[model samples]
Target: MKLVLACTAVVLLLSAVELARPMRRRKNSIAQIYRAANITPVPEQILQVNFGGIKVTPGLEVAPEDAVDLPTIGFDFIPGCYYTFLAYNSNYSISFLSPSIVGLYVNLNGDMLADSSAIATWLGPSPSPGTGINRYILNVYKQSGLIDTTDEQLLSYQIDRLRFPIDDFVATYGLSGPVAGTFFLSQYPVFASEDCL
Candidate 1:
């Protein structure tokens, strides 16, 4: 009887140790992701971006240094997924920035562009006194191939820059537009957007 009790105790100890071991790695099952956002089944592709500590609500003001984690992507973000991300100030002198690490420019494939001979970075919104709530928008698009940057600042740094529309850029690759995007407004007074734009 005593021998039987000892054997039972050893079996229980082994079972506890196995239960505490780390689980095995597996493919990124996206069912949890869609459910977390309360959305429909995962599309052919989706880009998930989040600016931690940001509330997608009203009366919000954000600083430049606040960290923005790299956009979360699905398993579909393969080596072929050359994506371009742009940041815009609606009231600026009609310009856009393919924002990167330290305010430099890079193409959709994450390759650095010419004449932007600096580190890759993103310079957050530095709204002017009268800019009146700037809409700092970020749009990510799929690029079929490399697109060159024509200007040191962007395609054009002046009023003519307005012609470079993000939707059109996306459509050029036979894609509708950014699979996902999120925006936050800068307040000079109030804002026009209240959700992830």
Candidate 2:
């Protein structure tokens, strides 16, 4: 009986370790992907991004059109504090390691239900042919206070929304705590581009 009990205990211990492996791998994978892309560090809170009637998890492959509409960003907001939702494409340029901004929307009143401020309108992923997987990151930044933006500036942003320096923008707006974020992968249809072949 003693030997049988000892074997059972060992089996349970091994089973617990096995179950924990995936969770640890998941955490590491999230960080690894974010770091690899050279985007801002991964936020502590992970936002749930639902696109095209499906949840867009990290590293999930998606077609460009599947992300034509804005994904539903799910996160718990802190009342009285402002937040900014920005989408970035880390592989937009043909040159290696070039990144650009795809969208920018600010929740001035700290409410997602109302019409939020859209500094730069949403432009879905349109990676050029032959460019491999492009990582589209949706970052939720908690602002220190109300952000000031002029109509002329907003118009200019729409005109030129590429090669955005994310760090500079964060400092300019006093943005803190990407409080939450999520990212997905998208690529152009290689088959459609015979020239790319």
The whole-model C-alpha lDDT of candidate 2 against the native structure comes to 0.77
- Angstrom error of the Cα, residue 61, model 1: value is 3.8
Per-residue CA lDDT of model 1 for 22-64, tens digit only, reads 3211113333444454433233333343446454321235554
Candidate 2 structure quality by residue, lDDT tens digits, 102-142: 88887555536236788888888888877788888888898
Residue 50 in candidate 1 has what lDDT?
Answer: 41
**After superposition, candidate 1 runs with Cα above 4 Å error:** 1-60, 64-76, 91-121, 148-164, 167-176, 188-197
**Each model's number of backbone clashes?**
8, 0
Worst 10 residues of 2 by lDDT: 106-115
TM-score of each: 0.43, 0.75
Clashing pairs in 2: none
